[model samples]
Every structure is written in C-alpha cells, then in structure tokens.
Target: MIIPEKFNAFRIHQLEDKQIHSGFEQITLDDLTDGEVVIKVAYSDINYKDALAATGKGRILRTFPLVGGIDLSGIVVSSIDGRFKTGDKVLVCGAQLSELYDGGYTEYARVKADSVVPLPKGLSLRDAMALGTAGYTAALAIQRMEDNGQIPERGPILVTGATGGVGSFAINMLSNIGYEVVAFTGKTEQADYLTSLGASKLINRHNIEMGSKPLESMQWGGAIDNLGGETLAWLIRTTSIWGNIASIGLAGGIKFDSTVMPFILRGVSLLGINSVEMPLSVRQQAWKRLATDLKPTKLHFIAPTTITFSELPSAFDAYIDGNVTGRTVVEINENL
Candidate 1:
C-alpha cells in the first residue's frame, strides 16, 4: 500500500485548437485531491460516456485536463475515515467521478469516502468493474420495475440497445429473475451472444415498424429501454396495462411524439433510471443483489475482454464507433 511519488494517468488535455484528447501522463500525488480515501486503483472500465468525453463526440466532461473514467474498483491504500482503512477492497461508480473530478484512469484514485462501496463478498474487483455503472443502472431499473409490481408472470420484458453494456446486463438480470426478455438490437451478428445472455427472443432494431397510433398491440409486460425516441414511444404504446418502462439513455433521439391515449387507456408507467446520484443505501443494496440474485451468469459473455492501461485511449474509439459489443475493463496497476 505504498503511495507512489508519481503515478501515470490517462490525462485529457484541451488544446488551443479547442479540441480534447487523452493520453498517458506522469503526475505527482499532490496533483490529485486528498479525499477521505485514497485507493490504489486496479481496474477501470470504458463506458459510452467515457468515449464521448475522450473523443469530443459529446459534452461529457464539464472540465478538461482531467483524468477520465466513470467506474473503478480496487484496494484502499489509506483512509482518513474510520469507516474504511488501508488494505480494504473497494469499488466506486458514478458519483460524478469523471465529469467534475479527476477519475479512475490512473494508478490511484482519491475519492470521497461516501462514494465508495465495499466490494461485495462474492464479487471480485474485476467482476465489480465488469458490472460498473451499466450493471448498476440495470439493477436500478429492475428494482424500480419490481417496486411497480412487475414480475416474471406478467409477461415478457423488452430490452432495447441489447448489445450494449446496460442492455446486456438488463437481459441477463431480467432473465436471471425468470422474466422472459425480448432483446432489440441493430447488430444482428450478436444474436447468438444475446441469446447466450438469456434473451428469450431477439428483434432487429430496424424491423420494428410502427404507425403513429397512440396505442399499438399490447406487447411487453415491462421493459428496460436505453434508447429514448421512437423506441420509447413504441414501448409506451405497446406495453401491457400497468406495465412499467424504465428509461435509461438518450442514445437515440431525445424526444418523441406520443399521445395521452396510451397513458389514459393502459395506465402505463414511465420510470426514469438515473444511476449517478443514487442514494448510498440503495447502492449498497444494489451491489449486494448483484453479488447474489442479480449476478449475471454470463458476464464472461457480456464483458469478454480486458485492455491494459496503455490501450485505453484507442479503446475509446471502438466505443465511439459503436464497435464494442460488450464491456471491456482497463487493467491498471496489475504489475504494481
């Protein structure tokens, strides 16, 4: 648990050209914030937000010349609080780690003590990062659905953007709880992969043809929707009476045309899933569930790869290009 004099971090720099790009840089410990806890970070994962922030594809970062990683898991090297101590295994996700603060793409991370979650008993650091924010959001969605009285007996649930990290976790978690999952993705090549992750049925994103009807055939019992536009609108119209739809992303267009017919007639509910500011107690429960009941059986299939710390900059390109099918963790400080 020796703190390094200088650590290597994937630092994003803003140039005079008003463009931002990330690369490895050597920085001293004083350069990082001395929060309640300092962790010798071991694993970090790339998410769509990270890609957008790194590649200037979207407005992900509120500031520049900062380290960028939204999810990280590792061991605590030192703690100023009695709740945590040196040599403790811990993990963190969301909590604005990357957006407004120096983040996980570093040899070490110093974060607020309250933002860290004790790594669940049955989970490894690698597994924790594998789940990361995506899995957390999926769990949050299901918890919201269950609170709305959703159950396996209701009918099949639909997961849009099924090839991405959140969608993959949603399929696995919903199916693990005995709900039949209908996964929708544009990537037809991932048919076998999605099926292996417990998708009972697969639908091509392009094949979903819908009219402007306020109500379509009652289809889904409940749904975990990552895309927002037409797909969400369709789910609202087609979901069975009393069914819930948890909206998680805006990867598709943000707004959609919808009418009151579905809501007035079907009593459908739209739940917005936000993982960043989730209460700490809720995060603990979600992580515990993920380590037990919600643990994805096919995480090996969902997050099938790992990249070294040096490979992180290039990895963002794959995410930006939408070539990433499953989660990939960045291995940091493994050699240390």
Candidate 2:
C-alpha cells in the first residue's frame, strides 16, 4: 500500500489565548507523534472523553496539536516492529491516544507499536471500534471482578449509568453469562432499552433514598459502577460480603465520604478500573475475552449507529450533553 503525502486529520490545538480549537486539517505523517506503526484507520468511535477533548468541555489533552480520538481499528500500512507487519488487522485503545499522543481521528494513524493489539478473531475492524474503549473497559472490569471471586450465586449485579456504552455492554455480557443484572439509571423512561440489553430490574436513581449509614442492607452481590461519588459510597455500604465493586467513571462527582465498616466488616472490595497504561499481556487478554466469553451478545443493539467521517464533527455534542444511548462508530476509511 502506497501512503499519501498528506491526509485528513482532526487536530486539536491550544491557541495563544489558552483556548482549545479543533478541526480537520491536511497534514503529513511527519506532523504526527513518533510511532513505529502506521495504520490506515478504518474506524474510530465516540466516547465521553473524546467529546471532552474535542469540545473543550474537559481538559483531556495533555499536549497541544494532537489528533483527537481515543480508539481506532484498522489495517497496518507498515510496521518497523517485528510483532506486527504490513496488512495486519489491529486495534488500539486505552493507550493514551489524544491524551499523550496523536489519536485515531484521521485517515492514517501513526501509533506506537507497543500500543497495538492484533485484531482478535471473530471481530472485524468496524466491530472492534464498535466495542472500542467502552467495551474493552467493561470486559476488563468483569475480568477483575471474577478474578476477585465475583459470581452470580453471590447476588444480582447492579450496573449504574445503565444506558451508556460501558453500562450497556456490561449488562448484556453479565446477563449472557447467567448473572441477573439490575440497571441503576436516571433515565427510567428508557426502561425498554435497558431491558432489551438484559437488565432484569431497574432502580430509578432519582427516587431512591440512599440513607446515611456506615453500612446498609445488602441488596447486590456485586456491582459495576460508572457514576462515582454518592452512588459509589452507597454501593460500598450496601454490597454483600466479598462482593467486588468496579469503579470505572466519575461523571457524578469526584469526592465521596465513606466509612470502612463495609470493608472491615463485610469484606466488600472496591476495584479501581484504569484502562490506560496497562501491561501488553493484560490488554491482549482483555481483547481476546471480548472476542469470546466476554463478548457482548447484543452488540448491534448497543452500537447500531455508524456515521461517515464527515459526520464526525457534529456527533460529539450528543455525548457531551448526556443524550447518547449507546456507542457511535466513526468510519474514517471503510475501503481500508
């Protein structure tokens, strides 16, 4: 494959006024961050972090003038690394793209070979992006929980932020594996959508009274919590003995007051899930499971929207506004 001298990239720059400006620009490979592998990016996806970086709603980029997409799936154009070769299918996620390096929001992405994972069998380039960081994070959380001894027989699992991509995938994957899943969501109106993804019950986060107690009644065997702060504190108190609560996001608030009674008395474990900077073997194992036992059965239902590259600029707002239901994959170069 012959590489283009200049390709389209959605670049983010911090101007002299300290304001963030992002838009499409034609650039050469030399303008990108240093990497051993060059990819003809086939697909990228919208995540809340991607929206924050693009819209300047949050401080996600650690450097100026970087391509803006956290996840990408595509075919390798060339590789100096012995582990990968030209024409190999691969995906990159949770490797600090857009934050510390040029990301996937371009026709071509030059990425560190260490950040790449060979596309697991049973998943296409598009399918990989459909899963993206959201699906990968969900699978990682489940793997950590199960490794800590989480099981269906312990109790039903509660999934907060149940309509979002990670929550939706977690619900579907857990339910498929025999755990009864309960969705805790503010959008109770989307009950049908939640149920379709295999949620056995719904807890309206709006009306529930989370009492101020060191520990509360044990309602859940385990939990996958996306909204942190009070919800996390509540989960910490109410989780049954030996249950693992995987804390993935902090959309609610950062600070939360908690007592150790839940930990000391009940042995409830709170596992922090950080997707970035993971070991290569750990990253590969997660993707392998995402293709097999942990694969989401309702993938299309959870991520049915695929927009062209031209439509990418208009899509981030919905995610920032908390209006997006599931995942949205961006097609950068489908011909690749």
Candidate 3:
C-alpha cells in the first residue's frame, strides 16, 4: 500500500484570542513528528478526556493544532522498528496521545513503536476500539480492586456514572467476572440498558448524593467510581469492612470534602485508575484480560453507535452534553 503524502485530521488549535478551534483539516507528512511506526488508522473512539480537549473545558491539550483522539486501532503502514512491520494490526491508547502531541483523530497516526500494542488474539480491530481506553481503564480498575482483595463473594460492587463509557463497561466486565454489580446513574431511564449489561440493581444518582451526615449505613463491598467527588466520599463511608473503591474519573468535581474516618476505622481502600502513562507490560495484561475473561459478551449492545469520520465533531458535542448513551466508534479507515 502506498502511504499518502497528506491526510485528514481532526485538529484542535489554540487561537490568538486564547480560544480553542477544533475541526477536520488536511495535513501533510511534514505535519507529523518523527516516529518509528506509521499506522493507517482504522478506528478511534471518544473518551471524556477527548471531549475536554476538543471543547476547551478541561485543559487537556497542551499544544495547538494537535489532533485530539485518545484511542486508536489500526494496521501499521510502515515501521522502522523490528517489533512491528508493515500490515501488522496494532492498538495504542493513553501514552500521552492527543496531549503533548498529535493523536489518533486522523487517517494516519505516527506514534513511537514502543507505544503500540500488537492487537491481542481473539479480538477484532472494531471490537478493540469498542473497548478502547474506556474498556481498558475499566479493566485496570477491576484488576486493581481484585489485587487489593475485592471479590464477588464479598458483596455487591457499585459502579458510579453508570451510563458513561467507563461506567458502562465496568458494569459489564464486573458482572461477567461474577461480581454483583450495582449501577448508579442519573439516567434511571436507561435502567433496562444497564440491566442488560448485567447490573444486579440500578440506583438513582440521588442515592449516592452528599447527605447531612458523613457516614451512612454499610452497603456495597466494593465500588468503581467515575463521578469522583461526593460519590467517592460516600463510597468510602458506606463500603463494607475491607471494601475497596477504585476512583476512575473527576468529571463531577475534583476535590471531595471528607475526613479520614473511612480509611482509619473501616479499612476501606481508594485506588486511583490512570490509563495514561501506563507501561506497555501492564497495558498488555489489561488487553489480554479484555480479550478473554473480562471481555464484554454483548459489546455491541453496550456500545451501539458507529459513526463516520465526518460525524465526529457533532458527536463530540453530544458527548460533552451527556447525550451519548454508549461508546461512539469513529471509522477513520473503512477497509479495516
């Protein structure tokens, strides 16, 4: 295959007035930085962080005219490194892509060969992006929780922000792994969808809201929290003895008001999940789990929409507005 001299990208630029500009534009080979592998991007997926970078809401982008996508699955077009060669299917997510440099929101992505993962056996490229950073992060959280002594027999595991990408996949993966998952979401209307993903019980968001007292009745044995502020504090307060709460996101608020009582008295543990800057060895373990035991059986049911590259901008709006229900897959190179 002949690689093109220029390709299309969803570029984000910081303008002279200190504003953000993001949209699809043509870019050349000269635009990309040096890398050992040049991939023909097959598919990419949207994450909450990508939304922040695109909309200028979260200050996720550190440079201008940078392509803003955090997850990519594609085939290598060329490689200077011995680990991968031309035509090898690969995936890359959260090695600082779309932050300090251009990322996967393009027809082609040039990233260091060290950052890529050879696509795991038993998973398709489409399904890989369907899992994407969201699925991978969810996997990492559960793995950490299990490592810290969380188990299905301990009791129910609560998943906050259950309608979002990470939360949805968390519900599915945890349930598939034999844990009783309790999904917490403001969108109670999506209860059936959550149930189909194997949630044992669906709780309204108000249930976890900050209340007058700091501590509440003992509830879940473990939790995967995405909201991160008051909900996490509540998890710490309400979890069973020796329970674990893996905090995955800060979309609601960054800081939480809480004392150390939960930690000191109840022995509850808080695990922070970070997909970015994860070593490739750990990433491989996560992906292997994703392809096997932790793989969502009804992946398409969990993430139903697949959009063309042109529709990504509007999809970005829907994502920021909390209108997107599941993972939004963007097809960059259709042949894959």
**Candidate achieving the largest lDDT:** 2
| TM-score comparison, 1 vs 3, better candidate | 1
**Candidate 2: TM-score?**
0.99
Model 2 C-alpha lDDT per residue in residues 1-336, reported as the tens digit of each score: 888999999999999988889999999999999999999999999999999999999999999889999999999999999999999999999999999999999999999999999999999898899999999999999999999999999999999999998999999999999999999999999999999999999999999999999999999999999999999999999999999999999988898889999999999999999999689999999999999998888998899999999899899898888889989999999676
lDDT of 3 by residue, 165-210 (tens): 8889999998888999999988999999999999999999865555
The CA lDDT at 69 in model 2 is 98
Candidate 1 residue spans exceeding 4 A from truth? none
lDDT-best of 1 and 2: 2
Give Cα distance to truth, residue 220, candidate 3, Å: 1.0
Pairs with steric clashes in candidate 3 = none
TM-score for candidate 3, please give it.
0.96
- Which rank order by lDDT, best down to worst? 2, 1, 3
Computed on alpha carbons, the lDDT of every model, listed in order, comes to: 0.89, 0.95, 0.88
**Which has the greatest TM-score?**
2
Write down the TM-score of every candidate. 0.97, 0.99, 0.96
Candidate 3 residue-wise lDDT at 190? 97
